[model samples]
Target: MKRDMRKTEREISKEEAKDILLKGEYGVLATISDEGYPYALPLSYVFADDIIYIHGAKEGHKLDNINFSSKVSFCVVGDTKVLSEKFSTNYESAIVFGKAMIIEGEEKTHALKHLIEKYSPDFMVSGLKYIENDQHRTTAFKIEIEKISGKARR
Candidate 1:
């Protein structure tokens, strides 16, 4: 279900939105808890081939929420500049609406590897070893993006 940006004038191209997603340092993943409350948490993620990859402990609140309902939203902010005098700020960001599917086996390995490449490029040797040793203790998610939109006040 794609929704139009409220501020059409501030909307950016899909390509630009993707660029922001790629360069973002971190993103907040939004999910619905079993209690019906919205749960949002910041996490390091990798955006690849139109899908977003995130990993976490196999058992926890986040995973519990995902298992309860696959629907979720993720947001990443690319850049910002405060305008204290104007009482506003210049910013660029992208939001993703998607269904999160837990991945395992080969897909999980690939996603984990991608995360390492993106966040721990300098520790690849050790990262691969870590994945091989403790992959079973962790879980990876693949977000099948249904709709994505970017906005900017630049």
Candidate 2:
């Protein structure tokens, strides 16, 4: 992606980066371990269609670094206000390069109910008592989008 004139040439349209990851909430998941080292976590995601849903705990360290490298890189950003210094840089960002798996039965309980109705839609009315007990204490995944790019700085 080397064509930088400070980079923006109108390239931010995978449904506008999935509507900024479905109205932007949180993102920053880059993983690589098994001694290769490089793990960044700050997740709370759920973007469908092109795939991107996350959840952890059934074990730690980002699921032992995606079970020793599933090669992932997910990102989402929207909410940066600094429109000055040449009148640009308000911000909207998305980056995804994926190959993460581990989603299990019933598509990991339907992607955790679409990540709880996209980050908690009023607790989804307790969704049948947390789908009959929090689907066995969290563990969901799906990155699949082998390529994605986005940008907006104004």
Candidate 3:
């Protein structure tokens, strides 16, 4: 990243960024469509290790877009308090960039389970339902981190 003092906020540690990504639950996913158009969609994600996992339909615009171009960007932001001022609003946000790859078989199954645990830990008791039934129908993709950066402001 360029050293732009104006764009930088309180630099968040890598660990803190990972925590935010893992716990934030919701994020926006950006992808390139077959027609060479940029597409951004709000999605729920799970962060494990250095990979961000997203679950979606077996067939749709997102899947089509990813298939056309593996390059993608994902971002997750934490709570923000509006600073009603004359100029602008203050906020905290985290962003990640990576190459997205469609995961299948065991990898996909594992990712799906991890996603469920992160976003809905309460349903863990019925974990078998996810491992067996849901896994067969849904699609999961992993974004292997090429780079990650986060910032926070008061």
lDDT, candidate 1, 71-145, per-residue tens: 999999989999999999999999999999999999999999999999999999999999999999988999999
Count of clashes in candidate 3: 0
lDDT of 2 by residue, 1-154 (tens): 2343366685677778778877878899999888888999888978876688788889998888998988888888976787677676678888888888888888887788888898778888796479568778878889898777788765
lDDT of 1 at 89: 99
Better of 1 and 2 by lDDT: 1
Against the hidden reference, what TM-scores do the models get?
Answer: 0.97, 0.35, 0.88
**Candidate with the greatest lDDT versus the true structure:** 1
TM-score, cand. 1 vs. native: 0.97
* Comparing 2 and 3 on lDDT, the stronger one: 3
Alpha carbon lDDT at 90, candidate 1: 99
- Residue 9's lDDT within candidate 2 is 83
Q: Model 3: residues >4 Å from true position, as ranges?
A: 1-6
Worst 10 residues of 1 by lDDT: 1-10
lDDT string, candidate 3, 1-154, tens digits: 3344365558777777787787796999999988889999999888886789888889999999989888888888887777667465555667787889899988888888888788678898687586787676778899998777778876
Evaluate residue 48 in candidate 3 and report its C-alpha lDDT on the 0 to 100 scale: 81
The most accurate candidate by TM-score is 1
Please report, in order, the local distance difference test score of every candidate based on alpha carbons. Answer: 0.94, 0.81, 0.82
